[model samples]
Target: MLKKSELKDLVLEYGKKFLFPDFTNKLTWFVAGVGGAIILTPTPLKLIIYNWLVDSANLNSGTRFTLAELAPDAADYSVGVVLIIGALLHNIANRYLVYKEKKASSHDVSGQTNQIDKELFKKFLEDFPSNSDSIDMLRQQDFSNSFNIFRLANLEKFVEEWDTVEREFLNTDLERMRRELWEACYTFNYKLSMGAYDLNGGPIFSCIPDAYRGTDNWPAHVDEKIDELNGLSTTCFKLYEEFVRFGRKSIA
Candidate 1:
């Protein structure tokens, strides 16, 4: 004997697959068109008309159905088909109404689990240090040394921190934040690594002829780099702010 909960789950699962809204909507049309056509098919001539359609469509060329095979009489087959069609229509319409009503009432009936999830998500954001020390590990690097080496080390540390935090929160939104934060970190690191920057009162690397001397627009290029760095900084901080906002938002 199955439990009530298990039976309910099974039925819900079956409904989700077999009677999906779109599928049921299409099924309604299919049954209406095909069943109505068959019912209106003007009898004694009913099987002949159907078999003619089949033959015209080249459906199973060697075979045809008989009235006896379908039902004892033409009227009996029509009646039986009409009853089956009516029952199916009723079942589908009822299920569709139930589905819609449940959807409309979902937020009202969100219950304890939704509240618990909101709390858990908020708490997870509070505990996550992406906005704090983890991000700082990348930002506070000394570029005078092997900059890529520092970036790789800091990036690894940030990833380690992310890995630790990821185990705590299973939310898709949180996972998206992690991905965005990682992208921001990598973008900043790549920008800093590739470009020669004036740091510590000197150029970190000799400016390339292509970057400086090859074009008279080098000053504009330098301005573009500055703008890009500012944008990257803004993006990184925006993610941090988003995290803070999500944490602070009303759980109710």
Candidate 2:
């Protein structure tokens, strides 16, 4: 299990990693500044301009009166239209920029996450023998303690892999992945504990339930989980890609 400090650090780090790319975009400030100025200016200027155009074109009384009252009668309508268009464009552009940023950030985050996963995998592999020995010693002295260690080690491995998957994909389905892996680890451990052993006292293949002991079932289960992860990653990436494409198309 992770320490409180470690979990806190992970949350903070990932939160920042996800948020900073979005916070850096300056389009919002630019739009707000320009929009504020446009909306705050006097309405009389628009009335005067419309009045002049009305007279210059020799328009009828209806048109002339309409132009003269443009500020009072149409000011709200005109401003609403402008604001709507401006807001729509701004949101479209922001989405495109955010999508681009996430794509670039994922590459960097994935690299770091991969490195961490590999390191943890290596550490676990290295310590497996020692862990096995410790388990054996505890089993002789206290079975509960040995089970506790086994559980901890299993959970640690799961966490390491979970982190790796998150960093590698940066998908919104990270929570799902974490939950699935935790459940898988728990089930595996439970089954292992119930299994039988050989004369050498090592767990035997026959010890596991026949449902889990098929020649191909374990590999198939692993593949199925991996496929689920890949599908989630693809979905998030496609979401970003579609947002970028839609923004570009709207501009065109």
**lDDT (10s digit) by residue, model 1, range 1-252:** 999999999999778656544434666566556766666666656767655766666655667544333332646346547755775766667778778879878755565545665766655555544555535634553322222233244444544555454343344565566567767866865685566544344423323333353445557666576567556656765776675565445344
Alpha carbon lDDT of residue 97, candidate 1? 76
Most TM-score-accurate candidate = 1
Instruction: List residue ranges in candidate 2 displaced over 4 A.
Output: 1-45, 51-76, 103-107, 130-134, 141-252
The TM-score, computed over Cα atoms with residue i paired to residue i, of candidate 1 is 0.35
Local accuracy by lDDT, each model: 0.56, 0.46
Query: What tens digits encode model 2's per-residue C-alpha lDDT throughout 1-252?
Result: 999999999998776544443323464445455556546655676567657877877655544433436545344445535764675575666578668879999988877755564554344335433245332332232211112333235334544454444433223243344345445444544543443233234332233234444445555554454344334323433432343344233322
Can you give the lDDT of residue 83 in candidate 1?
A: 53
- Clashing pairs counted in every model: 0, 0
- Model 2 earns a TM-score of 0.30
Off by over 4 Å in 1: 1-89, 97-120, 128-159, 164-174, 185-233, 246-252
What is the number of residue pairs that collide in model 2?
A: 0
